[model samples]
Target: MTKAWAEEILDWNYEPPYDFYNDNNKEESMKELLEAPYFAVLNDSGNLAGFYCIGYAAQVPLGYLFGAYQEDCVDIGLGMKPELTGKGNGGSFIRFVLEQVKGSKSIRLTVADFNERAITLYERAGFKKTYMFAGEEMSFFVMEKRSL
Candidate 1:
């Protein structure tokens, strides 16, 4: 997420705070995603489209529903190039990740409540809201998908 790109998500209203990519810290962000089991999305021409990282986290944010569920779970983050937002690439990107995590029984992610478009997309991809929380400045849905 670049500074310009982070600004885009900020426009979505009610989104949770994220480590908006500062030009200075951009390299650090890329370094983390460039490294392992992460799936890097690419275009038909072989250019990178976006990237996602999957793992387990007790909670996406501290004190936001704090801690409850654990064990066999997947956590993830994804960002498509800003220009690609309305282009319909998310569904496929998520499907690809699911294919890679095929043997896992569940996957989880956090989405801010103000992002209606994103929430709808996840629902279409089979994720169901399992938990929700609202803090002084943000609200979010903690969703999960059972193995397909």
Candidate 2:
């Protein structure tokens, strides 16, 4: 991801229930987002729509204890521009990401259990819940979609 886009993302502040998704540490988040696995998503107007990361960068450390990433699948982590969330953009946005990774036989992702909006979006994109694990303060679900 470009530094400009990363900065924009760091500035995004979601409202109440979704506030947890906001980036609190600019330095750390910038470092991660600029790494190889992460990519920027732009809308039709060429504005930053969101971002996604693949493989190890997408995994949650606590999930390892539950064997959530044991399977051979392309792990994915993603975020939408806060203002676009819950506004009927999720379906297409997810489809775009899916298309980008269409060559993969399997795809997986993790989502906070409390984020019904994201869980529902993932389910609609054909992801099925495969595992659930508790974090220090919350819980997360490992979901997968397979083409084979």
Q: In model 2, which range of ten residues has the least summed lDDT?
A: 96-105
Question: Residue-wise lDDT of candidate 2 within 56-122, one digit each (tens)?
Answer: 9899989998888898999889999998999999999999988888764699999999999999999
Model 2 residue 133 lDDT score: 98
> Taking the tens digit of each residue's C-alpha lDDT, what string does model 1 give over 1-148?
3444333333332222332322345455344434434565667997656656676322455434556255456776566655576568778877876676667468888777877777899999899998777778777788888866
- For model 1, the stretches where C-alpha displacement exceeds 4 angstroms are 1-31, 34-37, 56-59, 63-65, 68-71
Query: How many residue pairs clash (N, CA or C atoms closer than 3 angstroms) in each of the candidate models, in the order given?
Result: 0, 0
TM-score against truth, every candidate: 0.70, 0.96
Looking at candidate 2, what is the lDDT of residue 110? 94
User: How many clashing residue pairs, candidate 1?
Assistant: 0
Scored against the true structure, residue 22 in model 2 reaches a CA lDDT of 83
